[model samples]
Target: MTVAPHPALSANLATPTQAPAQRDDAPIELSTLRLPTPPVPPDTCVIDVAQLFLDANYAGLLSLPIVAADGAPVGMISRYELMRVFLQPYGRELFGRRPISVLMNHAPLVLSVETSIGDAARAIAQHIRSPITDDFVLVENGRYVGTALVLDVLRAVEGRLADRSTELERAYVRLKSSQAQLVQSEKMASLGQMVAGLVHEINTPLGYVRNNVEMTRGVLADASQLIVAQQAALDALLGGDVVADAQARLDEVETLRLRVDPAALDDTAALLDDTLHGVGQIGDLVINLKDFSRLDQAGAQKADLNHLVASALKIANHILRKRGIEVVHQPGELPPVECAPAQINQVLLNLLTNAAQAIEHERGRIVVATRAVEGRAMVLIQDNGKGIAAENQARIFDPFFTTKPVGEGTGMGLAISRQIIEQHGGAIRMTSSVGQGTRFVVVLPLRAVVREAA
Candidate 1:
């Protein structure tokens, strides 16, 4: 195949960038950047150079290659030097009859097709004996294939650099945006888990509060009737003899006691205490949720794994209680972990909620345990629910892979959980057998190095 010179070659050859033509194996090869080689037969005359130039259709080209009979580059000839020689007195007559090889550069700049532009430019710059305008021969497998100009290589490098800069800028913008979205996604998922248990948790205490208030109202009414009875007795005493009405008043008081029910009044203090305790329980859930969904605390910090589990449990209690699932916490003494507390809380909550949702029947039991092992903190959450099938277990961590009915799950819980845990220098894995149970083990380092952005 005959390769032609670029149409803009003439314009660029005059003011080429000061780049060398040293050969190198880089990503961008000279083969893709080289122009067609301007060649002449070994026997071609110096006077025939004009016809050679016209044949190649590169009038502005300053250098041309002299090829041997076998098409190997023998040397190069420069238009500037050629014109100088011909301008001498009888110079054309003296040399025009001889082959161009007599005056051609025998050791011109040469580069391989595989040469990288940087190395090529460096090589060209190092060849101080040769002019910058000299076109370097591009050879492949020891045969002349094409030629390259420094200007073309520099232009290619500049364009490539510009494209790379744009690409990096786009990637950076996407990273920042994704980080923001990830934080919001975690918050929403945490909120969703908390909301699942919210109705039952709030209703339980609210029901008790209503019952206690009703009972207290009845107690107040009974007390009011007793006060009226005592007042009537006082009126009788003030208007008549005290001793006479004392016995009657005492009888009325006895009747009033019967109506008031002394046992009920005795229980008032305990009933109020129970109501107060119920309200406090509801309040605790709210606070736990608030701490669990700490979206603003995105930075890493020292945290206790046990406390994170406890907070997650509190947030997921409504789900556990609703399903009659018993949670047994067996926490071992552990050191604090350096991580993002809120994200860790989010991970724990996801595991607990998933355990609750996996239960197909009542009496489901979830066991959450934490321990320190080999300078690492491990959290084990096991559930005696309908365990995952072997085929489906592997895909549970994949995004949008959920067994829940439509709209009941976004399938992002485990996926996001894994991301958060891994970002904290931790790992989460699960083991399950269908109809038996499922166990999730999360291992985290006590002190974690901050993760770099992808």
Candidate 2:
């Protein structure tokens, strides 16, 4: 039996709208891969369908959609099916005049034009079989729109994946850049606070040194007057001047000598010693500032953790003193730990600062102790302050997590400290009881280890 060809099928042979440019933020739809191949009516003969496949116009297509009278897709007829039929002995004569539906796939993979490329690929995966016979059909509102090749859908999906991978790589790069910036900003903020304290630390010594110099200047002036008077008396005596004149010069010398207290000389010497000590104190502070400001330097070295702790403590002394916090340093003999000194200094300072801030009352005490345990360097910082809450302890190291009031903290100190420690092949842990106190322990390997940037 034969069937009349549908006129609507011929009208759809015109090219469809071109696909839009792909975007990373947008999901690609199946319509972008659609090919407007004309469909065949269900009653069309096998011979006529075979002739259509042979035409160069439809050579690239694997199958043609078989639509019902109302434009609904019923099945698909593939080139492989026709080739099989014609290749068989006496096959063309037996089935050539029959309806193509007799050999068409009654159930094809049908998807809407609005389906995402990923979803379309998944559907094809589930429904596809070995030896890949037919192309999937694209429809709109339950009616046939056009047919698309399985190979085209596969290519589109692959392209989308490649695009997604590229986008992810870019995003990762941006995230790393942002992280670096944040680390540097925190360093600057810490430095600013440290500088304010250091200024006071330096001024205390500078004030005494200035006063000592002034006192010494007064002593030197009196001594010079005595020297001049004694010289004059010697000149009068040696030049055979009158006894009265010589006696007058000698009397002037005696008077000046009496005015210069003998103890003033001794006191001047002591003042000089104190001045030297004050200068040395200033020098040591400058050195600590230099070490603390080495934030831009990268690379690790074997360093005495005790020295780093001391330096951090010195810088933070002003803060602790202002709050009347007592700091106890108990450093034990241990092997040197290889690490980035500047970064470790930053971590120590951050911890000390946090400890100082945690205390809301006078009589705050912070104990910093170091020891070697099992070939690893350990630093324990315990603070007697209002400690972290039980629920908030777990997320203390999470980025941007803070219990402090807004504008008083950046919430990155603990997070960055943890990152720095972990990158150095170390671990940091915390234990606290709400009103009792909090203790942070940092354990580090005593040998150098390759570290990756976070």
Candidate 3:
């Protein structure tokens, strides 16, 4: 007949062990969490261990682990216990002759290197040994490796949880934003598709009309030369014609000449030239719009920063012109930066638009410059407009934080620009004085470094 086990022991035996709950996102493990091995005296060593404690004090160790032969952890000894033993009268004389293992916990908790932080934490919580303040010994395949404090494990796990939570929240926000953008894009695509066809229809005819206008201009030039020659001949033949038919023909020709006004012809040519220039500008604007809006053009390659800046400047030329903002471009010698060109162009254009908008004066000044120093490329955009107030400068790059009136700003320009620059291993900085001017500096690495969201 088997004797019945004690009630508590029976309960413990009946309870099926459940694995510790672990989040899928937890990044901490025993191997990474364990502190470096602390001072471990051989289990056979005498309790001159008090001296070991003194030595440990100098070395800044909190505790010591007693290891047996073959480097297997036998037990751990804490500084407090050792100090208590030595503080007693003649305690060293009585105990110093014995092996340090006498004072160490023979049944110390052990953890394997592959244990998850969650499992280790569970083990720590369930431990019922006396002097629970002792650090846990970390081992790999029964060989002593290191020690872990309960505090370190808890802190690491907590930090990991916080980071994972933050990441999920950010991802959720991005997902919602992306969904909205996709819906808006679909509508825009439908509109653009139909408009593109109309544009093609109009452009095809407009192109030929321009060609014909050019040809007409050439023909008119030739006609002007012929008319001049005819007038010279008419002057020579005046009052000298003998045949009545020839005289009448010459008179008719003279009448036609009188009807051709030189000034009017000049005006017509000027109008054609102006029309052609306007058509060209429209074509360019369409191209820039496509470049700005195309979401599928995210290919990275070696690109000239100055060329990207110029393209952006060209796109924003009209805004500058309207305000009479004078742009001073100093394209410094720079190396090619590996980046997605169109995205960088958009960032530059956004900065330029902000620069143009900041100015309240007719003689606004914008200085755009590029330079390479210390293996990094830099772009500087400075504007002398009603500058950004000092108080508002910090939040200028925050999304939806704008100084402009309600409909005039969505406040995402600088925010998006900074994001794009940072994605390419770069940074955007700003300096401004309320009445003087504002300057934006974009710094980018020549070589891109891959980064994960913090």
Candidate 4:
């Protein structure tokens, strides 16, 4: 996910340097250099630096930079504050060619390094907004500390998530030993839960096996002897000359059948059979669960792409239930692909979720199709949603950027997805237009079987 392009700021991103300063009691005027600067493009505002100020805003450098005591900047200011001035005509003219001293908003909202991000976000919402023209500034004691640009806020939130992907990528490298330990830990936890369920699952079958054995022993010991007696009588009748003997033998066999109690035997067999069938179902469930959560699949392996997709679809079936999103798969019994199955699953999840969210009014449809291309396995996920705008297509993978409303997403999904796919020796490409829809194509190497043959 990428952060939306800010209206006030240019495409360039700037990283401010931290410097030392002496404390001053009287208000110190901020200059243009201390304002929000992008590291991407380093150029002074050529027209009038005043244009950098939000529309009609009184604030100079409309960006409030966090400064060390010596008046060196540690952080920049807020655009929302600059916007307040844009509403007035004088604020617009006042911004023109004016010295930052006369125009800069003196009181910058500041925060400490230890401050929780939640508190920082709240501070920005409450005190630092425009009219007040302050934002949560990073402060260490009485000195300026670090800065959290609005563009970088979400990126900062996922502080721990950085290593998560790095671990997955260079997983076999020497440095990945710690990452392997983490994956091992994950495996152990998953195995523990699986073991518990399996024990409960096996217990039912064991209990019935005990009951079945007891019933089978009783039937063979008691009822079987009676059947033998009836057979003996029938043999004697057949050997005799008298019709009365044959009638008596037939009656004897009927007597044994009547004494056996057929209902009990039927009940025992049914219970044992049902228990066996249930055990089979439980084993199947365990296998699917294990397959879904396996972490070692980080290494690329030759496997069935269609089978993997189908399994992942089954696992994610619950997510699609309430969204009115239908997933259609045009999968053939495809050749194996050299890929990391888990990463592929993660990519599919992101695409599927995005497809579901893209729908506006009525139903939405996503088609996942597979085919062969060159020496690769070609997978396409197509969605009928609001679609991507031309302006935003290139920036879609920038971290912390999101098109969705505030609080709905952190915007790391696609960026991470692309990285993961690329690490597995694959490429992900997308195509979309405003009114139409979006299609994501994932291309991976064909199975080694096919490659070797070539």
Candidate 5:
């Protein structure tokens, strides 16, 4: 009965299961490390230059001490240095003012990646003039390889330890990065769950198309009867069947003694075809929506604006039909946008749906136009509903600021709309009148600027 368990397996069974590690209170080395790269070719943006100026002015990246080119020492870029190059009295005009490259300090100080964080911080303290030092780009061999910021190094080395602690912590971060990926994988799973529900919600209108086909058949039958009776009475009076020239003058159906002739049953067939066609359009919208919400969990890419618009229309059809509204799309088309299609579609969906529902009473009209303007594609969704009140216009885009009844609105539509557009480096604007209607316009550049840190 005394069979011995393997040491490793026995220990595994004997000890309680270990809890998974969380990032809180963890060392900098344990913190997520983005093995830094030189902010150069491929990922760098000219905008980064402007971002440097703006971020430097705001985020205080300007004064963070720079390590020497040889990883020997550190120094800070002063306000005077920044202003001399940045042209600061008009900092607000920087984006339209000039290229950012002219402002960047070349041959700035650098540091070795293996340099202990404790020494790096001390080096920064010894060289820093004012405010604080933030970065220490680590170089290896002869070129810049990765960044080892003051903050990152401080986190890497905390408590009574030596180089071993830093190595352990850095190793932990390297391992932890893989773990963080698993966390992202989990979020993707949640998004998949959202899409499943959306698919079900979309099938609703498709179900109604089948019912509408039947209703159209009935209405066509009634319409045919009215048409046939009129024609038959006219034919008899002209043909002199039970009605001579003198009797043709008879006033009404009863007085004329008219006989009924069956109407062409085929008219009902044509009417049914037309009605069914109208109803099937709603189904196409559902397909487009499914396309927009597709589970492409990766990053941004080119997207079909037309297809995206169609899906949003499908999702909003619930409100559009009730208002007896018609949507008109212009003929102009576009190339795919090099941005996040799903997110952009969400914004467009919100705008189009909002426009369709803005009208509380009577039939309305919605117009959508898309085309290139000023090196960017512009999309406009306009609704002829009761225009927005001047008082509420400013606050309309604020999150959770809806005027809808409880349970019917989340007030997040416009706010979410704004965020989605901005994420794509775009702008959205709205125009409205008290008695007329509301209109939303979105503008996004054709090309995207890839951002990198220098």
Candidate 6:
């Protein structure tokens, strides 16, 4: 029987063209790999179908699609299967006249034109066997489009993987850069807050010190004038000057002395004392700010936890005071623990800030306590405030997760705090109830284990 070529396939029997370059994120269309090979009807004689495979145009094709009268793909006939059938003795005579359907793959791999490259790869990987004997059929809307070599699909998939790997590397670098920026941004924000508070704390003493210095200057001037007048009067008396001139110098001295109150000297001394105290207060604040930041210090060192806590509190005192939040510090005797003091100070300040922010009311109380446990140090911060919701408590440490109104919080404080603690071979945990309160516990090893760069 004479077999007819599929009309649609015969119109486009040219060699396959290379697919156009696709974007990394774009889905690969199966039609890009489709080979417009003519399909044969199932009724075609096996020997006649075999002759079609011998055509130079079809030499590279591993399989030909078999379509039904209505254009639906029914199966595939591979070159391997055809060669296997004809190689045996008397195999040609026995099967040459039989219908090609008898040898066709009943359950061939069929993919849609819309299938993504990754999906297609997965489908082929699952069904493809060793020494691949058959190519897959590409269909659109359940109708035959053309054939696709399994090797082509594999190559497409491999190329896609390579592209994806490159894309992932680029994405990872961007992510790291963004993370670093966010961390620095948070640090700068904290620094700004500390500076504002320190300014306010320093101004109070600075204002008084300025006033006292001015007053002391005036009193000293009056006393100096009185002494000069008295010296003139004494010189006039010793040199036997005219009585009227001596009387005039003496009278001037009395007038200047009267201008300088008897208690003015003592008052000046008191003012100087107060000025020194104010200066000391400013100095302490400067010292505390420096200690809290520790920007000059690097690496790990043995540091007193109490000192760190005090520095953080002093830095955040203005914030707490403005909110009328009372702080109760309970410090226990602790050995100096080896740690990054700057990082620890940051963590402490974050906790203190969080505690203060959590309190929604004016009469809020926060208890900060520290103690040395067996081989470790522990710090506890407890606040009487509206607590975290039960469901949100789990994600409290997740980066960028915040309940604060947008623009008010970066949500990195707790997350960074936890990271710092954990990096020092420590742990941070929280306990909270919706309406009652919240508490955070931090545990640190006496000697931190240094971690290698990731």
Best by lDDT: 2
Candidate 2 is scored at a TM of: 0.93
Tell me the tens digit of each residue's lDDT in model 4 across 1-454.
1222232232222344432241332211121113233311112221233344433322333354434334334444345534545556777666534434343445656655555544555565665544543433454454443334533433443542565567667765655565445434433543453355456555666676677777767865657867787777778776884887777777777877777778867776786686677667557656666676776776668888887777656555544544667889999646778777766766676676676677674677788898887878888988888899888999888765689876444466687677667676678899997767899998877753211100
What tens digits encode model 3's per-residue C-alpha lDDT throughout 1-454? Answer: 1222233223322433333455665545787755554335554444655566566332444566666546577787777777787789997777777777777777878898678887888898888345555768777788766667777778877877788789999999998688456434433533353245345544654776687677667657656765875775576577566566556666766775666666757666766776777677667766766765665656677889998888778667766776789999999999999887766876787788788889998789999999998999999999998888778878998867888787556676677678778988999999998878999999989986624321
Tell me the deviation in Å of residue 135 in model 5: 31
Per-residue lDDT of candidate 2, residues 118-164 (tens digit): 89899999998988988999888997888888898899888888987
- List the global CA lDDT of all models: 0.79, 0.90, 0.71, 0.58, 0.56, 0.86
lDDT of 1 by residue, 137-246 (tens): 87777777667776777787886688778988999999878866765775586587578668678888999998998999999898898988888887777877678677
Question: Considering every candidate listed, which one attains the maximal TM-score?
Answer: 2
**Which scores higher on TM-score, 3 or 6?**
6
Give per-residue lDDT, candidate 6, residue 46.
Answer: 86
The clash count for each model shown is 6, 0, 0, 23, 5, 0
Compared with the true structure, the alpha-carbon lDDT of candidate 1 equals 0.79
lDDT of 5 by residue, 152-253 (tens): 545545442665687789999887686445434433433343355455555564565566666565665555554555566677677767655335434444
Error of 2 at 399 (Å): 2.1
Q: What ranking of all candidate models by lDDT puts the best one first? A: 2, 6, 1, 3, 4, 5
Candidate 1 lowest-lDDT run of ten = 1-10
Query: What TM-score against the true fold does each predicted structure earn?
Result: 0.69, 0.93, 0.52, 0.40, 0.42, 0.80
In the predicted model 1, the residue pairs found to clash are 20-120, 20-121, 20-124, 21-120, 21-124, 22-120
How much RMSD separates candidate 1 from the native structure? 8.8
lDDT of 3 at 147: 69
